[model samples]
Target: MTDTPSPLTYAPPALAAREDLLAAVRFDAAGLVACIAQQHDTGEVLMMAWMNREAVAETLATGRVCYYSRSRKGLWRKGETSGQLQHLVELRLDCDGDTLLALVDQLGVACHTGRRNCFYRAIRDDALTTIADPLMDPAALYGDAHKGHSHG
Candidate 1:
């Protein structure tokens, strides 16, 4: 029989690149990175927030969606308070591997201001315009002087 090359002798570079990319992720001193929220179906960018490794792990594990709240300095489960939860569909890293794109199956409004997205304002003719209206009232959702609120 003719000599054949062994399959184990070849390895894809993509595998090695992914490993390196994972290793090089820079977390802040508090071990948090900014994560961008996106609508899975419409591809609309909702908002951006911080997340720690624990948040990432927990999100992947539970698939209910979680984030690191910089204001409260703790994990925030989406929809726990406002009833506007985001179900995790997939998580993606940017080309440089520093940024994160969270594709989610969002339920109800995604913005605290009652809008469908945080980016409700649009720029036109060098002026800002309100493109969308809030779906829910903040006062009704969070109440007055909303403090120490947890979605979980």
Candidate 2:
């Protein structure tokens, strides 16, 4: 059984403004949008996740970064199992209104591989190079729960 998300209770004026902002967003044909999580203080880009309208609403409602997992086909709360929760500091929308930027105070590692961020690889000397070290064991974090999980 799935747990119903608690309704987002926000201040009246803030809620109205948020409603307006949400209304202005242009979701893609698949009812999904790209939400890029960025470090709140250092301005470092963390991981990118998919967010439908419900995900966005849940994020605002909870102040915890939530995403729609394509693999699970359900709403995924960040760091739920990994202890790498992202606390939303600010939310921004691009001029095109199709993409979202979530500035957050990330805890622990952001990547499932135990890296700080998913974009820990870079093109160096014309070759892809790893840029960060794994902070923790993903096996320790998730165990065999996600063993069958695959990125499509």
Candidate 3:
């Protein structure tokens, strides 16, 4: 009933030119794009972060995932302090090119709260419930220097 090509037999459209990867993305007014990091193998969503042009470029060049931190107002290289790094496996752009999905190999906990991922809380029975427990103590991960500040 539809003319759409089957996913099994679908082929990617040819690019008009070999354009720069950054040029294909549409950033926000703050020159930032939303990026979702997911477990490469298990398909578990790790965390969400913002990426600027510089972050994207650096990630591609170094094969390391980098994010722009609005709180720090600088580039936040994942696992720089917590030892929980996210290695880049594949970077995918949405159809609108406004969001990016980074398939990654997470080294350790992906949350500042010491959980496996950032999505620990879920709404249950009309109340916010804590689902996942911290894998490691926050102090152990960041030490006293980063006491109050969030890791993400």
Q: lDDT per model, in order? A: 0.72, 0.80, 0.81
For model 3, residues 68-141, the per-residue Cα lDDT tens digits are 98888899999888898888776778999999998788898999889999999999999999999999998988
Estimate the overall C-alpha local distance difference test score of candidate 1: 0.72
Error of 1 at 10 (Å): 33
TM-score of 1: 0.76
Specify the poorest-scoring 10-residue window by lDDT in model 2: 3-12
Clashes of 2: 0
lDDT of 1 by residue, 1-152 (tens): 64322222322235465355446667778787788988876788888887787787667566667888877778888888778888777666777666778778788888777788888888988999998988888777678634554321
Tell me the spans in candidate 3 whose CA falls farther than 4 Å from its real position. Answer: 1-19
Highest TM-score against the true fold, candidate: 2
How does candidate 3 fare on TM-score?
Answer: 0.85
Give me the runs in candidate 1 sitting further than 4 Å from their true place. 1-24, 145-152
User: Pairs clashing in candidate 1?
Assistant: 80-151, 114-134, 114-135
TM-score of each: 0.76, 0.86, 0.85
Ranking by lDDT: 3, 2, 1
